[model samples]
Target: MNLNKAWGILKENGFKETTKRNQILEIFEGDERYLTARDILDVMQKDYPSMSYDTVYRNLATFVSLDILEATELSGEKHFRMHCESDHHHHHFICMDCGKIKEIPLCPMDLLGAALPAYEIDNHKFEIYGKCPECK
Candidate 1:
């Protein structure tokens, strides 16, 4: 999502805008890759030398809960990226090495649903993780 839309969501949710929050959003705005807390802290430290990990993590959690960011686990650590702007149903292919993401325009549930006719599924998330072409 764009900065304006992100700010609007924050306001709608009664969240106050802050310089740190704006900087966090800017970090994710133009990037398609996921970033870990450490990755973000490194950049944020440049501007806010006294920033703590707790503060960075708190904001990340807030963003995820607000749907402004999406989270995933890779190599046993959580990584985050801005929520996709697509209005259509889709999944993703994530690069294990570089944190890059590629949109997958297909859903596997179509076939998985057929295989499990006895069960009802309400929701699901699908992502394939591997090295992207450039990383490979």
Candidate 2:
């Protein structure tokens, strides 16, 4: 999502604009890779030396709750990226080395659903992790 849309969502949800929040959003703007809290902290510390992990994590939680960002576990730690702007449903292939994401248009559920015909499935998330070509 774009910064303006993110701001609009915040406004619609009765959130006031703040410099820190804007900066957080800017970090994800135009970047299509997932970022860890440490990654954010590294960038933020340059501008606000006193920034704490708690503060960055709190905002990350807020963004995820608001659906402005998407979260995933990478190498046992949580990473986040801006919500996908695609109009179609899809999953992703994440690069382990670079954090780059490639959209996967095929849904594995199509095959899995057939195998679990007796059970009801509510939802699912499928992601493939590997090195991207450049990283290789």
Error of 1 at 40 (Å): 0.8
The 0-to-1 C-alpha lDDT of every candidate, in the order given, reads 0.91, 0.91
lDDT of 2 at 74: 77
26 Cα displacement, candidate 2 (Å): 0.3
Per-residue accuracy of model 2 over 42-117 as CA lDDT, tens digit each: 9999999998999899999989999899999877899999999997788999998888999999888877757987
Q: Per-residue error at 101 for model 2, in Å?
A: 0.8
Point out where model 2 deviates above 4 Å.
Answer: 117-120
Q: Ten consecutive residues with minimal summed lDDT in candidate 2?
A: 109-118
What are the per-model C-alpha RMSD values against the true structure?
A: 1.6, 1.6
Q: Local error of candidate 1 at 60, Å? A: 0.8
